[model samples]
Target: MSIVLSDQDKSTLRAAAYGAVSLMAAATGSPQKAATNAAIALRSATGLVGHVLAANAKDIELKGKTVAELADRVLPALTAAMKLLGEQAPAEAGNFHGTILLAIEAAQIHPDKANAIAAEMARKITAALDAGVAPAAAAAGPDRPELQKAIEEIVDSGFVGVSLRVHDERGEWVGSAGTAELGGAAKPPTNGHHRIGSNTKTFTATLVLQLVAEGRFGLDDPVVKHLPEFGLDERITVRMLLQHTSGVFNFTGEVYEDGTIAPGIPIPYGTTGQEWLDNRFKTYRPQELVELALAKPARFEPGTGWSYSNTNYVLARLLIEKVTGCSYAEEMQRLILGPLGLSGTVVPDASPELPEPHAHAYYRHGDTTVDVTRQNPSWTSTGGDMISTTQDLHTFISALLGGKLLPAPLLTEMCTPHPTGIPNMDYGLGVFVVTTDGGGTVISHNGAAVGHAALMYSTPDGRKTLTAALNCVDDANLTIGAAFQNAQQRLVNEVFGGGQADPA
Candidate 1:
């Protein structure tokens, strides 16, 4: 039975509906301002149905706009609408028909909206299609029932969102589960862009190794020999910095066994939302981050023990800058991203904006939360500041293992592990050596910051691989951290088999 609207309710709806259409038309005169106001009005409305109407109305008014222009107008509407739907719907809002319907309708009515929606849809559908068409795609393709089950398990395990991409026996498969945010019905973009955290280390390491292959520096050379101003111990070599055995104190503060905090840079997790938001665009020099760590006592004497330190990689960034006389980003573009044709990867520098067609990422502080989805990544600096897609990451790892990046001898050296005493896990230069129970070994390096994580894995020879990007609510206590790790391991096993080792 149709739910009847009260007379007053119908009148309000009519007035509001007409007002929405008029606002869209008027705002079109100052397309920018109209777009802004339309976004604000749409945000104030409730439910997927309202969002659908608002988006439709806006799209109709903004006819003839470019895809980028339409996105600028529609995305805010989509974000606000998704947030409302996620909040109002029951926790077990099964099937997500409302969101799908709204999206389809928006695409059908407005050419601009249709273009934007179709572009995103294509990324997902093409990945699905490629799985069947490519000969090698069948190895780790997303069609595997086991792979789908693993993705479902992650969503079931309490993660707010997850997206996975794998390459193995069945080819390449990409899957996503959970809402983009806490109360949204739309699934996180299965191939959406995300900050790839310390996985940036592997990129940084690869660039440095590429220079090594070019005869820019030797692995055993002391870091102090290149940048002596920091007073690094001569024992700290380039290899140690890459391998995290350099004993450099982590500049982002460190937690000891007794739970004491050693202070360093003002990381986002430790600051007020407004403060972090304000400083988001500020540029941080690698030397500044390194000196900050140097001011503290070393985590241990150089090479005494192993500990994860963002400072080590920041130092590597400085080394790249000093030696090449180019910005770390420029070097990355020239050395890694450009050569590999990784168009999806970005070194944001002091820029806070993501390219077009991405999901919104947020941070909850207290009663007042903030939208930090567009903040400049300079705050993380070189440590965890790169953005990339699962596809690009998959290509990168596959290329690296396939001998497209490093030479055979150096790649071998890069994968050599120094045991960390964690069962089945060891630290290589910038990667991890993970031993599967079935006796197969996968080389990988995984990392996460506040809202993102990256997983890059390869068989020894780089013939089979898996890479993924995950976005979620990252908290200090790591409440859901274990589940993320577990899900990653399960996906790796399902694709690469339990006992296959890297052939390198």
Candidate 2:
């Protein structure tokens, strides 16, 4: 299926695509160099998209005295370009979209300081691209209005935007409520990408378990055997790390049950407001993050108690790298993402690249609110630094539970629960096992990273699931934490037949 674009269409596409780079350059105040790099990235595209973008830009007029004026023309043009490409050549629609994002990335200057500005621009550009097509799905007519109400209530409860996907007996329903950005009218893209926060633990744990199944290492092997350089406790085993029974201090601060706080690195919550914003782009190596936690006293002797810690996952990530002689991201691709065909998922590592068509996330510092969507996630590492779409999450969880990614026995062990001091909801190797109100079980894990959050849940058999992404206005005080919890409970109760307690 070849796409034959009329000359006018090509002109519009070229102008829109190149004008996006101009917008990025304007945001960073580096027009000349940014334009040069962006042009190279744009022309680097292959196939039909390459030929179209490689065409001379001399005839195109990117008219605007100001960035706003330019965006007025370029944004609509971007949408029109996507609409025509999607209708005429759907595959090229993706290619065209990727090329534009690459150019935008190449156009950045001093991204550490310009991140919020550049991210806002990128969000606008992505929104325009997404606007070219209809939403992936919506709630209408007589089907699952309660489901729709759940997400709308999430927004009404102070979330900026929400996109939800459900797969059950009635087939799949995808819907979104609220605006993509503050003070904007566009709804969040139903299938957009998001930072899944600690949900990365499920993926990391699944990878470790898969390696264990293959005899690369035993689950009960001492963690020091794989990586003696860390001088980890000999009692800490691979199983303990995955199960969060390692008692390692969480690198991203901790809150005791007594309401006391132990601060580690500055993240987007607690007393980290101004400090976190100042160091938002600072990159922390996985080892550095783990070492920071190691410097703190252990919360309990290895295997003595259960506590959620980011360092455990960081150690797991390092173990995977040590055993496989590959980076965590590489093994993840080979074992999980590639096999599952999860094209929209990524282990960002130290990269702050949140892909296109995502709703904006924000953080408030007293009187000021800033877009925190583009901060470097290296601080969290494999603990919570992955990006994925709701569709990919549903696929991953369902497939993993459906016996596609692991052996049946190993999967059973993975889902086997350990008491996490929370009643009715127990911790598995890397997931939460909940006793639903109907006496059935649900396997789940949900996580939040500052202003962005994700909810991932599924029935025991994986026959039903609810996955969602949320964007909100966050504060150091965590004013939105209660709403986040209620939103999770509301959705789980409505979708999974009730009785979900204290999601992780």
Candidate 3:
């Protein structure tokens, strides 16, 4: 069965699944021991049910003064989860039922059924799971055809392929259009992984802020303290890096406001694209990327101006490694991916692989079109090298904005906007704070990497989100740049309450 659970529905499943274990733990009177054993069992679950239950538990909130009070909320949620899953995915409903039972069994302090109170709690849990639910009403949301039409319009605009996912009051809607490969008839996988380009900045920024939250470093501390080998400016603080106020030259290239372009590394564009294509598999260390940027004159004195510099995030990645004594990928997993159970997102350091079942991305150099899906992403490093699916993007943005990831004060700091000289949009830490034409606000970050690109946007509350992946024929000229911007505006208007204008 094809199932798309809304964020609310997912939240319900999390609460019900985790609460069931909490109830068993409470009954056992050895809450800590019982909870530990139950968690192991929950983590061991397999299949669709396993995926749902394993998401970041920070979103699961169970409020009650006593075990009885907790049961009142959890039992009903258990019934609700079953009803929703049964209507959408009957097989998954069975899996959910089985997983909870096993957890409760393992949670018992006396596994042989010697504890009367715990056994009684198990019976109550079983009864809730087995309770008959009313016939599910038709899902309340925009009909599928309308969403399908929206994406088809994007394909018509020139993209080779598009895969989109949106979560709103309509629950969840997903659709795809065009083709996975230029010459292939199959559509892009709705949940396929793709290079997330600069959206990796958001993840990198969050990691820095997380380290800050742990007191590892202060936002105002100079970058020199941790990464002294680079001899960075004393005025360049960690906050400046996260907010793009450091004025470091962009290693990708620089586009001055007067429409002048300065070259950086050879990339697929015009004739230079030929060189990039030939060297697509070559890897560059993060240090080398930073050195190249530093060799150029500072964009402006640190903290004196704002500029979008990929170099800033690469520096952030280096600092993360320095203070944590772990690689960027390791810290990412420990701090974010593992906690959130984001299995499809990858921080591919120097790796030239884009996992299986993904749409092919292509680039055109002169008259030759080549698949560039597996290029070494270390060229972009954390600035835009990570890979992820639309689903994981939704889970992440929703969790982060919903206050599950960062503490309140820090999240506020992350979202507060500074002028970026663009109309109606401003830069926040690693994200863009856009005030739509219709006067709505969204937190967003979009990225393009050669033939592949990804979009991530969400409301301030994170209750609504739009995430998408695109594959297209790209060249040095970025001929499709206009179409890419329009695609973003159209999807944002359709999914969020308003639309944004061109950055210019």
Candidate 4:
């Protein structure tokens, strides 16, 4: 009595299920609509089943039957198919329910076969609902163990919380570990919001380059021409700013070879926890951040050497504002966010709350580490004030690589490398050009501030992308820092054809 669905039947079932669920969800606006849509969906699914059964019966080929005869014969065959399938119990009733619903609504064939499929699908669906299991949950894909392990390792690596989303040949995988907030048991939402750190630099560079595409500015144009207040060396150009060759002093304090820390404005490092926590809500202007760095000596002469400087991007932010006569955030929205439909991403001005269903991020400071999870991000400004989910990050990177954002030639120039004195890696415009031993190149950027870090990576063609947000239990020993880098490499290699490095 058991029915064994052929591969074609299985494929049809999957397609039908998806169609049914989508139609039901979309057409359900009110109680009346829901009822009407549900009925329509069920009828459509039933008709599809009838069509499939009728087609199967005619394929027997031993007797050359006319269309009417085939149709007549199909009723009994469909009844048998349904009885046999019912005895076997549909392995994925949730999937079948959806497919059947759609077939019923759209079916233009035999009504009897449709009714049988609809009845069985309804029975199974009701049973599932009565058991308090969502139909969607029952049809969910299998869990990814490898991705789950990676998330757990990140949580163990001293982050207050961590969440990751990865996409590969296997499709999208998302997972999270650790509490959303300090001393809380709730796990972070894998797609929750977090500070994107220096990843903002990539966006800033993209905007600048977009304007460049429009002839508003030239890459080689001197930075001083755009923003005369920086007192920048004439050798520094817009290209240098994006490439981090401007040699601007890092405003968030610098560490020399001898480990001398020349402090800039007060940040979360080695400070009283409460002071930073209190000021977390304060807003910082891009000019203010740049001015603080300008107050200090240049890390090296502009265009002479390379050093990572938040001040450089802050200057770029100012340039964008000055040229567009709109806030950097607004420009970002108009050019990127709005166009890409990245609704979960934001350029938070002084906002502390992440968009709903977000993970909590925490900062650690003082001899006894304290949780500063809910501080204002204004201090980071254009340097690292953006908030985004993995989905948005993936969408942005994918679009950029897929040529939705920049022209091909400009994107090529943006990804071109400048020597950073680091082997195997070079700094591209606002991104890192990481070359793997496999002779493959990945464009990526990793950023950290206080407690949160964002990692973004994409292949040259942008067909593949990897994006993650990590919130660790940051400490003096840098326990989380080391582990985070390893995790990043592991994921990159796993998704992009590489291997893990020494964990030490």
The superposed Cα distance between candidate 4 and the true structure at residue 171, in angstroms, equals: 1.7
Clashing residue pairs in candidate 2 (N, C-alpha, C atoms within 3 angstroms):
none
Q: What does candidate 1's lDDT look like per residue over 1-504, in tens digits?
A: 121333333333323333333323332334344334333333322222333334433224333355455444443333333233233321101112112222222222232233443445434322322332223222224346676677777778766677776555533455667777667787776656778877888899999999899899999999999998888899999999988888888988887779898767666665443455567667776767788888888878878788888888889999999899999999998988766656557887767766543555655555554556677776567778888877568767877877889999999888888876577778888887878887777888777756666777878777677776566665434555677767676677777776322211
- Model 4 TM-score? 0.71
Q: Give the per-residue lDDT of model 3 (tens digit) for 260-344.
A: 8888887676457788999999998999999999999888998889988889999999999999889999999898876775656
Q: Evaluate residue 80 in candidate 2 and report its C-alpha lDDT on the 0 to 100 scale.
A: 87
**Whole-model lDDT values for every prediction:** 0.63, 0.83, 0.82, 0.63
TM-score of each: 0.70, 0.75, 0.76, 0.71
Runs in model 4 with CA error above 4 Å? Answer: 1-143, 271-275, 367-369, 475-479, 499-504
How does model 2 fare in lDDT?
0.83
Off by over 4 Å in 3: 1-142, 501-504
lDDT of 3 at 480: 83
Model 4 agreement with the true structure over 81-171: per-residue lDDT tens digits: 3333333332223223323423323231222133454444343433332232232223232445676676677677566677766655544
The alpha-carbon deviation from the true structure for residue 1 of candidate 3, after best TM-score superposition, in angstroms, is: 20
The per-residue C-alpha lDDT of model 4 at residue 183 equals 85
Query: How do the candidates rank by TM-score, highest first?
Result: 3, 2, 4, 1
Q: Worst 10-residue stretch by lDDT in candidate 4?
A: 103-112
Better of 1 and 2 by TM-score: 2
